[model samples]
Target: MKTAKILKVATFFSWFACIGLTIKSGAILVTYLLSISNPEASKNMYESLNLFEYYNHSFLNYSIIVFYKIVLFSVEAYIAYLVIQLLKKLNIKQPFNIDVHSLMRKISFAIFYLWIIAIVHNTHIQIIGKKHNFELSLFSSDFVFLSLVIFIFAQIVKRGIEIQSENDLTI
Candidate 1:
């Protein structure tokens, strides 16, 4: 029972983390779009607010980054939904039937790997003109690491679900 509770808590945290990522990505997208649509206004606002002084790049790169983050966030959110469904199935005492949890686990792993690649690509672009050694922005690195951690936790929860299912079948 305690194990089940722990799994539930972990699942909740994973979902929360995914949602937080989505929100962060959405904010980035909005900022990028606003900057693109009104460069002067955006620049003035940035100057006044004293934010993003380091992002001295063209709108094209901003657009591309925003698009990438949106796609990644969407994928992560979908995976979270799948995890939630798997949890629901486990809660309702379903007939030990499908390998949905395993499938979701693999999908989550794949998405996390892709996210890491995207972060690397973005970081490469951000450091193009800078004289830094493989410069990675703090935000990008943090999100990548957070996604990896969430996926790892998802895999652990998946394994627990599989084991519990097997135990149920034996009884």
Candidate 2:
């Protein structure tokens, strides 16, 4: 009961954060596009985000950064949505249903995809850092382990669901 309450609260907060991030990203993107079209607004809007601090002159770099941001935020939002769905499943009477197992696998897959995207993004940043003479924090060991753990948990849930179904059918 307590855990369900906690999960409900967390889901709400995470949803709020995800929505805020989406709005923020959209605003920044709009500002960036406006900066490109209008000379007067360009100076403030372009410098507002400082996204192109490393390579201000290269349009390709700017586009890549914007694209990366969009992908990252979209992935994050999807993860949050998955969490909400997972929580909803957990709070239900039949939490061990096939839908719950499916949600677990979906979350795991989402995290895996996010990991792959992050690697590409980090590599791009590192390459830019190398050329521009800047340092990057790079990947965190904690994140790697967390993602693997989540994936393992998802597999466990899937296996549990299979066993549960089997038990239900047996006399």
Candidate 3:
């Protein structure tokens, strides 16, 4: 009973995260478009990032960085959506199911993809800032460690599913 309740709460939070991230990504994209028309808009880009200098530096670099950010956020939102689906399909009484296993794998892959993008994005920022003498910085996340943990958990779940199937066949 407690586990089910916890799962319900987790599902709610995951849905909330998915919606919030989607909104954030859309707002960033809209800000980028607005900045194109009004350069002043770049001064207070999404969450007050203030990429005006980058905008002035090189339009291509500005667009690429913003696009990478959008992709990162979108991937995060997708991961949250996948969690919600997994939670919804989960059965407390019979927890080992193919859908759950597959969803776990999908989530792990999405997280891994996000990690890769983040690395590239950060590297791009560092190289650009260094080469151009700009002191720009983007917050780095420990996504590689996180993705590995989730991937390991997914593998454990896969093993559980296999064991459960074998047990059921014997009965």
Candidate 4:
């Protein structure tokens, strides 16, 4: 009963996060388009994030960076959606189901992809900063560990499923 309650709470939070991130990504995309016409639109991006200097530096680089940022948030929103699905489908009594295992694997892969994009985006920022002689930083390479942890958990769930299958056969 407690586990079910906790799962419910977790699902709620996941849904909240999914909605927030989706909003953030959409806002960024809209701002990007608006900034194309009115440069003032670039002043405050997606809640006071000022990338105006980046825009001033090089339009191409700015576009690439903004694109990466949008993709990062979109991926995060997708991961949250996947987590909500996993939480909804999870049964505390018999938690090692194929659907749960698959969701975990997909979540891990999505996290890994997010980590890769973060690294690339941050690296791009660093390279551009160096070449252009301006300091700018973005993204952290922390999601890789998260991805690995979830991947290991997925594997453990897979093993549990196998064991449960064998036990049923023996029974």
Best by lDDT: 4
What is candidate 3's lDDT per residue for 121-146, written digit by digit as tens?
98999898989887676746678788
lDDT of 1: 0.57
Give residue 152's error in model 3 in angstroms. 1.4
Task: Kindly list the per-residue Cα lDDT of model 1 for residues 1-171, writing each as its tens digit.
Answer: 786887699789768967876675666566666766555433333214212333445445544544655666666666666666666556434423355555555556756666675676566456652543323333244445655676676667667768877897999
Error of 2 at 54 (Å): 4.6
Better TM-score candidate (1, 2): 2
Say which prediction, candidate 2 or candidate 3, comes out ahead on lDDT: 3
Q: Estimate the TM-score for candidate 4.
A: 0.96
Instruction: Name the TM-score of candidate 3.
Output: 0.95
lDDT per residue for candidate 4 within 9-94, as digits (tens), equals 99999999999999999999999999998777877888787778788988898899889989999999999999999998888889
Better of 1 and 3 by lDDT: 3
Regions of candidate 4 where Cα sits further than 4 Å from its true position? none
Each candidate structure's TM-score, on Cα atoms with residue i matched to residue i, is 0.55, 0.80, 0.95, 0.96
Model 2, span 25-86: residue lDDT tens: 67656766875655344334323545445436566775676677667667778878887787
Arrange candidates, best lDDT first. 4, 3, 2, 1
